[model samples]
Target chain A: GDSVTQTEGLVTLTEGLPVMLNCTYQTIYSNPFLFWYVQHLNESPRLLLKSFTDNKRTEHQGFHATLHKSSSSFHLQKSSAQLSDSALYYCAENAYKVIFGKGTHLHVLP
Target chain B: NAGVIQTPRHKVTGKGQEATLWCEPISGHSAVFWYRQTIVQGLEFLTYFRNQAPIDDSGMPKERFSAQMPNQSHSTLKIQSTQPQDSAVYLCASSLDGDSNERLFFGHGTKLSVL
Candidate 1:
């Protein structure tokens, strides 16, 4: 069975600092789509970024993620963390079906 | 438009009882998916339907879980003989098509509690 692993369960960063939530996956499918989704408190999760091509960086709403097949990683990154960036982040890999990792709770301290 | 509408934001069911959750997908979307989220499992795909037809149900637990998309507008996930392990938030999501990369729009999930 395919699986996704998010190393960071909770990440805290000061505002204006760099942000990174580690995500790695193990799957047998050759062509897999990786994605990052953000869920605000009491809200549904929304797509933040997705990657279908290897080494291509996908960005949305000040967040970006690059899919690296060689490393089996799609780590989410942001240059400057914002107070508004605090939320639950989920990393997923889509083969014929979607598999999501345990989410990372990001807290950007102002 | 209301993104995705899931009825009964919360539900409580007793052990061995039946529980049914409903979802109304976004208009004009042809792909709908059901997922279960728990602290232990994170998020797990239960089933998906394309254009009112079930494309794959391989992820579903066959003995206790069933899903049906009778029409394009809505779908239902029913659990018979619910157990404590079945208590979790059930999420419904929709996409434009069956393409794996299509961005999914999710509804505020229904939180189920099996006592």
Candidate 2:
């Protein structure tokens, strides 16, 4: 069985503050593929970024994440948080099937 | 591309009634998956089909839930004797294939409300 862990509970920060959403996973596969999906209000989840190669940073929109196989972590980061970035973020491990983490609700306040 | 299409954006059913949700995957996708979303459980995988064949249904409830993919174009998920706790958004997604490298394309889910 595969599992994904993310930052628990709601994360609130000022609009201009740095954004960091922690994620870690456990899987049997040596080369694991991980993904970040974002779901806005009343919208379905959409893929923000995905990575397979270890230690390689994958960027999409204004966010970036690097898969660290040694640590089994893929933390999403951005230079600054935007009000529009407030949403539910999910970290998923794509083994045989996609296993999602309990999402983190990010609230960017102005 | 049309991504994925789910019918009846919303559904309302009595506690003891039955509900059937429909999903139309992308035109050429070989993999179709169903999931239930709720505040408490988050995204829960229900079942999936590959090439019009059932691949993994371990997440489905044995007695009340059933899924079918008679053809490559569409799939259906039927829940019999639905309960109040069965209320949640039902999401359907499709991918080029069922492989790990393929990213899923999700549709606007069907919000099921059981009274």
Total clashing pairs for each candidate? 0, 0
Please give, for residues B51-78, the per-residue lDDT of candidate 2 as tens digits. Answer: 9999999889999999999998899999
What tens digits encode model 1's per-residue C-alpha lDDT throughout A67-110?
99999999999999999999999999988778899898999998
Candidate 2: C-alpha RMSD after superposition: 0.9
Q: Which candidate is the best by DockQ?
A: 1
Q: If scored against the real structure, what TM-score would every candidate get?
A: 0.94, 0.98
User: How accurately is candidate 2 docked according to DockQ?
Assistant: 0.77
Model 2 lDDT, residue B81, Cα: 97
> By TM-score, how accurate is candidate 2?
0.98
Which candidate leads the pack in TM-score?
A: 2
Error of 1 at A20 (Å): 0.8
Tens digits of per-residue lDDT, candidate 1, B1-115, equal 8899998899999999999999999999999999998766777889999999998888799999999999999999999999999999999999988788888999999999999
Candidate 1 CAPRI grade: high
